[model samples]
Target: MLSLFLFQISLNRMIKTLSATNYSIEIGPLTESSFQDLLTNKYAHSRKVIMVDENTHDNCLEFLLTAFDDLTDAEVILLPAGEENKVMEVCFQVWNALSDYGIGRNDLVINLGGGVVTDMGGFIAAVFKRGVDFVNIPTSLLGMVDASIGGKTGIDLGAFKNQLGVFKDPVAIFIDPSFLHSLPENEVWNGFAEILKHSLIADSSLWAKIKNYRNIDDLYTADLIEAGISIKLKTLLNDPFEKGERKLLNFGHTIGHAIEGCMLETDSPVSHGHAVAIGLLLESQLSNNRGILSNEEFKEIEETIKALYSPIELDEEQIAIVLELMKNDKKNSEGKIKGILIHSIGHCTFDEVFEEEEIRKIL
Candidate 1:
């Protein structure tokens, strides 16, 4: 009887492992068998290429290889890790790698790292042969919830972040939360920033859940990925092409992207989430100033973000540069600056453009 009980427990563990591969986020939980299923069923006969960075290669290459075991032939591409590395130069590197791999239109590429890997790889796949299918196997929290789920793929152009990219959804995305255990503390914090943003935009319940997240360990659990992905998917399903109300996803991204550009101009670039953390606070203040967001709600946002990240002071000069970046933001229409602002939890709207002078004072 005891032997039978042990066998049942082992079978259940295997079943749990198999169940993780169907996730939409990047770093949820994936197993070797699930990957095989994707390759054999959904993407059979599709040439495969996996893109990664140095750190991700060191950390996850072995597991990735096991996932691709059935593939007799595959290609691997590597890039430098960090926000600074997500650029045209790296894009060119991927282009070259794809060329060498002979990746064709029918082929599929797998991005196997954090946001940088997935974002750049997805962009290459989108443009390669005028577009091909791609998949995401994100290894970081930020990549899982934000970058991997949305069809928003691109590389940073010059000092501008995400200035060059496209919105091409992948054939499939698999998240394995096991990867989060390997992430650095700061990287984990970076991902939490996006999770918090999701909650603020459309799911007050999720915001409340994240508010109580005590540390990195809390985010690695399956519950965080499940809740975060559900919120993001709901938003994208409503705005797949980002043509309308979906702009709510930019809650903190408006100023965050600009701040990212500012830091990129300097030698040190901020993580996407770190920059967005500052953006969230500043934008919350903007919402309050506009009288849409209540001061108390703004205070809640400020306290929540500050609980996890330290404030980065931006001087007048820095603010000027960020404004320039915002002027070129993709959401801007024919040179008019537009922003997505929040009025309350689960409430957001776009089409309000902030004046350069006005933003300067806010800075």
Candidate 2:
């Protein structure tokens, strides 16, 4: 009986892997009318609630309320905005709000802000009553291209980032570029880091296109957004469970998360995508040093990234501290500091492990 059960579980995983590739990713306008279109889809229930932040509530909720106005009943739960709020405490607040609303497995949760709202909101939905359905209506460029599409949901645990979470995808996602019009310049740059990372991993052509996005408005185009989205979707389809191929997506994330976490300890806080971009540069150099990528390829990546991002000037002490944090990344196994590195501009993955002694030397 045990053998048969294990076999069934293996078969189920295989089926899910296959199905993810077959799934067609949808990208279009996210408006009041889109909600009506979503209502036509098959689901367990129509009762849905949105979890948003202060800025999103002010800029988007009023307009969104009208979108769901015709539904039997829909509500919004607003939280404070910014990365500081992505904690267990905020997760509890959202869970309490959902409980008060009498939300159930049949109901759905909609994440309506940037990475913070989506990450925390998705975590709440994943744990509420064991598990519940949710949707992602990402308002920020970062969320639309990366966070909103991936099912990895979690809240930060103290100095560590995304230390607690589960892989739970939403029922659907709505990507509307119009919402990005109000985004700050830094935030737009933060999102671009992921776009660049996506390009570095699989699509050289996409990388070429991204290099041409000189200004923020360049990212607002549907073609650019769709290209970035397609790169991620294709990767996810190949490695939905993140056991192998999908790990490549973390090209800059390993050190990037650590740097962001370390910086948060001080007065300055680095956005997730920005930190990852830095990670990509440093790690790419490391890859070159290891005889992986050619010098020319490494320089091209560094030059392009530097064009958009000004590197953080860190002292030896700061670099050392951040490298220590990388040891605790959730992706590592048994405390081994495994990370994704590049063989070339368009090829990267998590096949390399950095030694603590060498890491210390680099810092």
Candidate 3:
């Protein structure tokens, strides 16, 4: 009886290993010993390439080099930093660089920066030579919990957000919290918005934990990252293609993305998290106006985000442009704008359409 039971347990473990190949998210420091084995055994024959922005190259590249001795021969491709550079032109440069270097189907691309690097690098690898293997080493807090977990990869189309892209999962994702040490304080705050979004949409317990935190600095830890990542991974497992449950993840992105697009057009641009913080407030107000979210909950959500992020005041003209951009969002259908609104904390409804006039009133 004991032998039979052990056999069943082993069989289940093998089944799980076989089934989990499509997606993975690993959180830990990248040390020389573990990484060397990964390179020697798993990626032995594959050519290696590491993609980074100027910022990451300056701040984070040495850590990777020290971790993997084999990377001495890996080609390094550096793109410009900032959301403004997350465009087709930059992608074109990366693609050209790959072609010039003769990168093949078996070669691996390592995305080693924040959201922009991961998003663009994943998109590049997804299409390069008809999809090559890639891994994400997320350097920013936003990247660690949010961008690196989701298979969504794309470059912005003009002033719009993620207008061109594909769903391509990396073979593995390595999240090293040490990367956050090099980021500025505002960048850390930028990531907290997504964490708050995760909490708002799925975990009320996480929301309670985050709301009490005095500052972004206090929120940086493996447990916090795991909380946000668990929400995202669980959501994606249910709706990998964003056909239903995954849409809930866009809680603040509707207006947030529109605002981001508008800001990208101006000389002064807000970070993705900054724009999302604003979206959280506006959308929460929309939820309140629609009689879904309670008055007290709305106030709490508004004040929490406001305390973390300074207000971004937009003129009427900018509001109009943002509203127009919403029409082009991938979530919309049949000429109606779709939004995800919370009925209460930790619960949300998606595919909720609102009229242009209704949205205008809120702005």
Candidate 4:
């Protein structure tokens, strides 16, 4: 059904289930029975709705339909693809569709696409009629490792990333790595950016191993996927919400989101992963200048990231725009711009207010 096997590890060897406070994530080597049986048993009586974007509609929706007959009657909602589509207008339209379908709180929504689908669909289910149970069937590498795993569901407000949203977990998340084949190379790198961030913030050994890879191919193994998932899970254990330790996950995201907004204004828009890759390097440098990260470590971080990703060249105007947006980032308090920084690889510090001048020094 899905090439049977996509990686070196066989079905059984790859790690299986992981749980957070209320939900569980079922990683690769999934079977029709593993997915279908649960749906038939648990959701037989619930109205089914499967939401996806244009790409997932063409690439992934059929695979899911063929695998699970339980979804035969599921209402399919197809959203327009791309970051720009992740807006309140789209959400409002989806809401109207839900109303048209007669969907209610007792129903179930299967978010069957990449990050955008899971993020926006979860938001739709959460706020619709006070809340509807939803599940994530992440079909992108980024979706599998980061977006779908966390309870953060949101849409962009203009160009700002995740500007409007909620922190509501899906009932379950089904991550089948077979879907990796459906992605273009750029899409794969987008997810790798988040996974790379994970290694830096909490897993030094993982980051060390990651740097040794000469080809991006080496990064796409089930072993690494499971390991990355575990690192993100570790944070959820102590801080399910972004109340404390979970903020570490937002390290590269602050500047990354701002960079993302800047590119959307240009001719060639940047993908989330591309923007985050750039943000990681800049923030790592910011950490160094702020005296939190060591000089040698910053060089290593810069070298490793630059080798894999082309650095973004922001013009003077764009730099000012990015700095202004950083001041208004969600992580900031009152008026100070704050973000996570690694004092050492695999370790980080937060609640550090970065002065505008300090940020300008790095930019």
Top candidate on lDDT is 3
Minimum summed lDDT over a 10-residue window in model 1 is located at: 1-10
Task: List the global CA lDDT of all models.
Answer: 0.77, 0.77, 0.84, 0.83
List, residue by residue over 160-249, the lDDT tens digit for candidate 1: 778888888776677788887788989999998888888888898778767867666687876677667667666765567788877888
Stretches off by above 4 angstroms in model 4 are 1-15
The lDDT of model 4 is: 0.83
lDDT by residue (102-175, candidate 2, tens digit) is 88888778788998888889889999999887777788889988988768898888879988898887766777
The residue ranges of model 2 lying beyond 4 angstroms of the native Cα positions read: 1-24, 32-34, 40-45, 71-73
The Cα error of candidate 4 at residue 59, in Å, is 0.9
Candidate 1 regions with alpha-carbon error over 4 angstroms: 1-28, 41-44
Give per-model TM-scores: 0.89, 0.89, 0.93, 0.93
* Number of the candidate with higher TM-score, 1 or 4: 4
Q: Candidate 1: what lDDT?
A: 0.77
Question: How would you order the candidates by lDDT, starting with the best?
Answer: 3, 4, 1, 2
